[model samples]
Target chain A: MKFGPMKPQRRNRLLLVLFVVLAAASAVGLALSALNENMNLFYSPGQITAGEAPTGVVIRAGGMVVAGSVLRATESLRVDFVISDLQGADVNVSFTGILPDLFREGQGVIARGILGRDGNFVAEEVLAKHDETYMPPELVDVLPDSHNDPETFKGGTRQ
Target chain B: MRFFSLPDYQLIMLNWFHRLGAPRSFYEISGRLLPVLWVLSGLSILTGVIWSLGFVPEDYQQGNSVRIMYIHVPAAIVAQSGYAMMAVAGAVFLIWRIKIADVALQCAAPIGASITFLALVTGAIWGKPTWGTWWVWDARLTSTLVLLFLYLGIIALRSAMENRESAGRATAMLALVGVVNLPIIKYSVDWWFTLHQPSSFSLGEKPAMPAEMWIPLLVMVLGYYLFFFTLWATRMRVEILNREFRTDWVQRLVVGS
Candidate 1:
C-alpha cells in the first residue's frame, strides 16, 4: 500500500499525539470530578446526626440488617425489610425479587433509588449479605457459597 | 516508610513526571514505582473486597450476591480505558514518533490485556449467578471479551516484528482497526438487548448505592487508576533511560553514577 513517497505518516503522528494528550486529560478530569462530588453527604446515620452528613441532597442511606424487620407479603411477590445506618437512621425498603439465601435479620445492605415522596427509601437495586472474601463483582457473588442454595437460611429451598 | 519518604518521595515523584515529558526519564523511576504501584493496586483491591464484602449492604433485589459488582464493574471500566490509552498512545507514537508514545503502548498493551481478562472473568462469575450461565453472547459481554483478545493480538504482533518501526506500525494498524470495538462495547447493551445489565454506576442516573457502599468502590477505582499511572510512568522511565543510554545526558547520568 506504499504510494511513491508521501504516506499519511505526518497526519497519523499528529492524530496520535492528540489522542494521547486527550486520554491523560480525561483521566485527570474524571479524578477531579470525583473529588468534587460532595464529601459530607457520604457518612451514615450516627455521622448524619453528628453534623457530619452534608445537607440539601438526598444521598444513599446505608446500614446493617435490623432484627424482626423481614416480612413476606400476604398477597403478592413483595417482601419488606428495614436497614439501619447503624448510626440510628432506619430506612424501610421494599422489594419483590427472590430473596437471597444469605439475607438475615442482622447484616449489611445498600439500596439505590431514593427516599420516596411517601418517605420510604425506594431501591432500584439492592445488595444484600456480604462477606470478607474476594469475589468477582456483578449481580451475584461468583464465589461458591451456601447462599446460592436456599436451604441454609430457614424454611426456603434453592429456587 | 518515614525513613525513605521524607528524603525520597518528592524527588522520586517529580523525577518520574519530568521524565514522563521525555521518553527516557522512566528508567530511573521504574525501579522505584513498580513495586509501589503493584503493592498498592493489589492492596486496594483486597481492601475493596474486604470493605464491600463485610460493610456494604445486600441489594434489595440481588441479595447477597450483589457484591460482585465491586470487582466486575471496575475491571470492565479499567479494561475499556486501558485500551483507549493504548490506542491514543499508538496514535501519538505514529505522529510524533515520540518514544514516550511507544513506551506507553508497550507498557499499556499488557496491562490492558490483563485488565480485560479480569473483566471477562469477573463478568462470567457475576453472570453465572444471575444470568444462569458462565458465559453470554451478550453484546456487552462478548465485545469486552473480544477487547481482551484484541489486546493480546496487538502485543503478539508487536513482538513478532524484527524492526521496531515496523512493529510499531503494524501494531498501530491493528489497534486502529480494533478501535471500533470501543464504541461497540460501550453501547452494546443499548445497541442490542443483552442479558448483561446496563451500567449501574453512572454519573447521569440516580446512583444505586448508599454512601457507604459506593464510596469505597469509588476509592478502589481511583486507586486502580493511580496504580496504572504509577506503573506507566515507571515503565516509560526505564524504557527511555535504556534507549537513550548512548546520549550525552545518559553518559553524564551514568558517569555521575
Candidate 2:
C-alpha cells in the first residue's frame, strides 16, 4: 500500500524510522551471530555420559570432583580426577597443569576441554568453581541428603 | 525522492527537541521530574540492596560473596550503557549544535567514569575468590578495562580543551569512536576462552541463572538505571544553572530558590 500524502515532516519521520530500523536490524543480526559462535555452552556429567555433549568441541563441563577420585602423577604435573553430576553419572577428567589452590576433591569444578574417545574429559583448563565461602554450587545438590548442611559440607581430603 | 523530504510530524519533533534544548525549559521541566526521580531511585535501590543482601539465599557455590553480584552486575551494566547515552548526547550536540546536549555530555562523563570505576573495583574483588587470582588478562576483564580508559579519555579530552565548543566537539568525536568498544566489552567472554564467565542474561535465551538468583539481580539492575537517571537529571540541572547564569530565567530561578 502506498503511503498517504508525503508531507515534508512525514517524509523526514519515515526516513528516520527507516534509518533506525536498518541500524537496529544490522546490530541485532551481528549480535546474534556473535553470541551463537562465541557461547561456550556448559554441560553436566550426565549430559556428557549420555553422549549429549558435542564430541571434539571445546565446551565447559561442571560438577563436583568425585570424592577420593584424584590421582596426581609422581614425576609430572598431570592429574586425574572424576567429576560427577551427583545423579548417578560421572566423567573422568585429566589435566596437566598447576591446579588452582582451591581445587580439591568433592568441591565444585568446571573443566574446559574436549571429551576424549575413551570417555575421558581431557581438560585444557580446570578451574575450582567455589565462591568466597567453601561450598560450590554444582556440588550442593550432588552431596548426600545428610550432608546438606552448609557447615558440614567440607572439602574431601585425598586419602 | 519524496522520502527525503521533512514531513510535518518530523518538523514538530524537531521543534520539540529545539525547545527542550533551551536551558530555561530544560531547567523547569527537569525540576518537575527531580522529586519523583529522587523518590523512585532511593526507594528502589534501598529495597533492592536490602532484599538481595539479606533475603536472598547464599549462592551454593559463591556463598556470601555472590552478594557482590547485586552491586557489581548492576554497576557494570549501567556504567556501559551510561557511556552509550553520553555518546548519543554528544552526537546530538555535534549535529544539532544543542547547548543542552553539550551540557548533558559534560555532566554524564564524570558519573559514567565513576560508575565504571565501581564496576572494575567490584569485579576485581569478586575475582579473588572465584578465579583464584585477583587479576587476569582475560578478554572480558581486559575489554572492561579498555572501556574504563575510554571513559577516562573522554573526560580528560573534555577538560583539556580550553575552548568550550572545541571541547564539546572533540569529546563528541571521541565518544562516537569509542562506541566500537561497547560490543567488545559485552561479547568478550563469549568470544574467547576467558576466566570471566559468560553473560548470565541474554535476549531470546533462558537466563543461565535460576529465577531465585536472577530476580534480585533484575531488581538491582532496575534500581541502578533509575539511580543513574536521577543523578543525571540532577547534574544536568546544576549544569544548566551554571551555563545559563547570564539568562534572566536563571537569575529569577536563583533568586526565587
Candidate 3:
C-alpha cells in the first residue's frame, strides 16, 4: 500500500484512535506509579539491609535461605533462619508457623512480618519461590554441585 | 475478479482472503475443516497429556507437581493470544465495517474468557504446592486477573447494549484500550519482584528446559491453538447462520442441509 494519505475522514478516525490510546496509556501509567511499591511481592534482603524497608509495619522480605542457618525449636513450631541475597548482609528471620514444603536451605524464600529494631524479621508466614529452570533429579545429580555455595550459586534468579 | 494484473501467488492469496471473509464462504469452508481440526487437536492433546504426565521425569525441585506446567502454561499462552485475536477482529470491524469480523469478535469473547479462567485456576492449583499460597497480590498475578476481568467486561458490555452497531464499536474500543494491559501482563514479572518466575520459554531465546520436557509442551501448545480455532470457527458459523437466516442464500443452505 502507498504511504500517501489525503482522506479527511480516515485521518480523523486515525487521530481519534491515537487519542484514545494515549489516554489509556497515561491512566494506567499513573495507576501503576501509585501502586509501585505494593506491586513488588517482597523486598529483597539487600533492600532491607539498605534500610529501604520500613520497620514495625508488616512487610515482606525475601532471599535465599542460608544453608545450615535454620534453627528449629524442639517444643514449638518456632524456626529461625538467616536469609541473604548472597551479595549483601544477611537478615535473620524468625517465624512461629509451618514453612512451605519447598522451603529448604539455599532455596528462595519470602517471609511476611515485621522487622524489629534489633534488625531481625519476625515472620508471620513464609512462602517458597522456585526458579524457571526445570530438570529431572537424575540430571541434577549429574551436574556439578556448583549451586551449593550461596555466592556462586546465582541464588534466587533475581531480575 | 482481478481489476489489474498481479503475480499469480499474490492474486490467489488475495482471492482466498476475501472469500474467507464472507459469512457463507466461511461457514462452508469451516464445515469441511472442522473434522480435521478435531482429530488433529484431539490426537495431539492426548499424546501431550500422556507424555507430560507419565513419561517425563519429575523435576528435582518440584517432583510430580511439576506436571501442572503442561496444563497451566498452555492455557495461559492461548488465553493471551485469544484476547489479541479478538481485539484485532474488533478493530477490523470498527475500521472497515466488516460484519464477519464483528461476528468473530462476538464469538471469541466467551471462549477466551473461559481459557483465561482456566489459566488462573490452574495457576492457583500449581501455586499452592510450590509457592505456599493459593494467590498473591504480585504484579504478574494481579495483571492476569485483570486480563480475566477485561474479557469479562467485554462480554458484559456486548450483552448490555441493544444496538448491535454501537455495541460492536464500544467493545472494540474497550478491547483496544485493554490492549495496553497485554504488555504489562507479559512484562510484569520482569518489572517487579513477584513470586511468579519469569517465562521459561520465549521465541527469541532457547527455552530454559530440556528437549525431552519442552517437546511435549510444544505439542500441547499447538493442540490448544488448534482447539481454539476449531471452537471459534464453529461458534462463528453458528452466529452467521443465526444472523443471516432471513437471507435467500441462508434459506437455501438450510434447505440443502
Candidate 4:
C-alpha cells in the first residue's frame, strides 16, 4: 500500500535527509571542480605498463628518483631527473618550482601537473614522499610489513 | 537603456509599510492589496530579466557573463542586509517584547538563506570564466559561505523547538551572537590574504561602474526591497491572524471570509 500512488504520503523524513545530503554533496563537488582548474592522474609505475600515457593528462607519477640521475644546475636552481618505480620504464621530469631542501636522489616523489607533448613530465608542483620512522595512516594498506616499532623499520632502499 | 530618477518611490512605499505591521489594519487590507503587490513583483522581475539579459551593455572584460552580476550582487546584498535587519528585529523583540518584531525575525531566516544560495551559485557560475576556478578559499567567498551556514543553523534551531516563544527567544540569542560575525564576514577579504577580489559593490564610496550600469542596478535594489516589504507584510498578517485567533478583529475577518 505504501508503494502505491494513492497511498497516504508519510512525513518521509529519510527522503528529506537524503535530499539535503545530495544537495550539499553536489554543491561541494561543483565548488571543488571549480577550485582546481586542472586535474591530476595518480598512479604507480605498474598502471602505465600496458600502454603509453595519454598525450595531455595532468598526472602524479609516483616513483623513486634514480641516484646520480639528479643533475642540479650549478648556477640556477633547476633540477633535471628521471623517475622509475624500479619497474624498468622511466620518465624524465623538469621542475623550476621551489624544491624541498630534503629532496634528493633515490627517494620517493610525487610530481604533479601535465605530461608535456614532448614526452617529458612538465611538473607544475612537486612534493617529497618521505618515509617516516613511525607508520602513517596512508601507508597502512600500501605496506605489507610496516612494523609499528622504530627499530623494526625494515629496508625501504630504492632501486 | 534609460535611467529614471524617481525620488518619490521610497517615500510612497514608506506610507504603505506604516499600515502593514499593524495586524488588524493589514489583515483587513491584504485582501484588497495582495493582487496589486503580486502583479508589481511580477512586472519588476520581468523588467529585470529583459534589461539584464538583453539591454545592458556587456562588460569589456567579462562580456555576457557579467549579466549574472544583476542577480548575484543584488542577492548577496539582500542576504547580508536582511540578516542584519533580522538581528536588529531580534534585539527589539527581546528588549521590548514586541510580537511583531519576533514575527519579522521568524519570517526573515528562510528568505536570507535563499538569497545567500542564489549569490553563491551565481558567483560560482561567474567564477568559471573569471577566476578560472569555481571555488576559492578566498576570504570573502569563505565568509559568505559561512553566512549561509549560519542562516541555516538559525532556521534549524527555531524549528527544533515545539514551543513558539521558546523558539523565538532561542533563535534571537543566536542571531545576536552571530551579529558580531557580520563585520568580520564583510571585511574578511580586506583583513586576510585572499584570492577573492576586493569588494567592488561598496555601500559607502561612489561605485566605479558607469551610470548606465549602476543606475539599473539601483533600480533592481529598490525593486528587491519593495518585494521584501510586500512579502513581509503579507506573512505578518497571516501570523497575527493565527496567533490572535480569539481576538475580535481576527474573528470579524474570519466571519467576513
What's the TM-score of each model vs. the native? 0.57, 0.68, 0.93, 0.57
Which stretches of model 2 miss by more than 4 angstroms?
Answer: A1-69, A72-159, B1-16
Give me the candidate number with maximum TM-score.
Answer: 3
Which residue pairs does candidate 4 place in steric collision?
A34-B134
lDDT of 2: 0.75
Candidate 1 lDDT score at position A141: 50
Docking class of 4: incorrect
Tens digits of lDDT, candidate 4, A12-107? 433433454356556655754464222222344443443445557776655667778987788886788987766566778888767753356765
Could you list the CA RMSD of all candidates, in the order they appear?
A: 15.7, 9.3, 2.8, 19.9
**lDDT ranking from best candidate downward:** 3, 2, 4, 1
Say which prediction, candidate 1 or candidate 3, comes out ahead on lDDT: 3
Candidate 1 chain A worst ten-residue window by lDDT: A149-158
C-alpha lDDT of residue B244 in model 1: 80
Please identify which of the two predictions, 1 or 4, would achieve the higher DockQ against the true structure: 1
Candidate 3 per-residue C-alpha lDDT over A58-90 given as tens digits, one digit per residue, 9 for 90 to 100 = 998888999899999999999999998888668
Tens digit per residue, CA lDDT, model 1, B155-254 = 8998889998888877876776677678768765443324444454556765544566677788678766866677666666666677688898788987
lDDT of 1 at B29: 52
Which residue pairs clash within candidate 3? Answer: none
Compared with the true structure, the alpha-carbon lDDT of candidate 3 equals 0.86
Clash pairs for candidate 2: A8-B6, A8-B7, A9-B6, A9-B7, A9-B8, A10-B7, A10-B8, A131-B62, A137-B61
The per-residue C-alpha lDDT of model 1 at residue A37 equals 30
